[model samples]
Target: MKKDKPKYRQIIDAAVIVIAENGYHQAQVSKIAKQAGVADGTIYLYFKNKEDILISVFSEKMSVFVENLKVIIQESITAQEMLARMIEGHFKVLSEDHHLAVVTQLELRQSNKDLRLKINHILKEYLDLLDDILQRGIQAGEFIEDMDLRLVRQVIFGTVDEVSTTWVMKDQKYDLVEMAPRVHEILLKGIQTQ
Candidate 1:
């Protein structure tokens, strides 16, 4: 598959920087190619068009988060500890990569309808990771037994997403990782059984 080629990963990483620097609409195939140190036509080998490149960037980056969450879910820890790790991991990844944070939080949101739909589809995999932790919490009598899975998922995702977006919007002047513990605590309070 084209994705296995080194250039494919290079283009994907370069695309993030290009798209993050120049919003998706303005990000050009040639710019991404230049950033990847490849010819413009080389991008076409891996992606259908500019839209494909943008969506692929999201898909590639989010896959890492999904895979990491999967591993976190399997760890032998309390549900609350797992949730804490998830928040910390999410913040750590974005905080360590300012370009990715800008692209995911700002550029992606400005895309057109169809692009947003595709991005949302990719996002579901990340959101679904929360269900395992939520269910575990309920089973352990930590979270409210009657918790609505969908709503709880939305709450967890929306909260974490908004926090990251806000940090990105603020020019990332503050430390995002430092806020993870508080975010975890706030979320736990809302979902945990009293």
Candidate 2:
């Protein structure tokens, strides 16, 4: 697959930075090419267009997220620990990559409806993993068994997503990763049987 090529990875990484700095609508293929150190036409070899590049950027980064969560799920840990680790992992990834945080939290939201729909489709895998974590918690009697699974999933995801977006909006002055534990506590309190 083209994804295995070194240049494909280069273009994806460069696209994140360019989209973060320039906004999705303003981030031209030429700028991405320049940032990737590839010719403008070279991008066409890998992507159908700028929209394809944008979608690919989300797809590639989100796979890292899904894979990380998958590893955490496989560990012999309590549901609480798994949830905590999930929060930490989510926050840590964004905290470590400011450009990616901006692209995902800010730039992606500004895309057209069709583009947002495509991004949402890519997000379903990540959301499903979150559901897996919540389901595990419920099965272990760590969370309430009577709650609506779908709504709970939205609440947890919205909390994490909003916190990251707020941090990005504030230019990331605060430590996001540090906030993970506190956020995890709040979420657990709402869903865990007290």
Cα lDDT of model 2 by residue, 1-194, tens digit: 99999999999999999999999999999999999999999999999999999999999999989999999999948788888998899999999999999999999998999999999999999999888888888998989999899999999899999999999999999999999999999998889988
Please give the RMSD of candidate 2 to the true structure: 0.8
Can you write out model 1's per-residue Cα lDDT over 1-194, one digit (the tens) per residue? 98899999999999999988988888999999999999999999899999999899999999989988989988848899989999999999999999999999999888899999999999988887789888889999988998889998988889999999999999999999999999999999988888
Q: Which stretches of candidate 1 lie above 4 Å from their native place?
A: none
The TM-scores of all predictions, comma-separated, are: 0.97, 0.98
**Candidate 2 C-alpha error for residue 90, in Å:** 0.4
What lDDT is obtained when candidate 2 is compared to the true structure? 0.94
lDDT of 1 at 127: 80
140 in model 1: Cα distance from truth in Å? 1.3
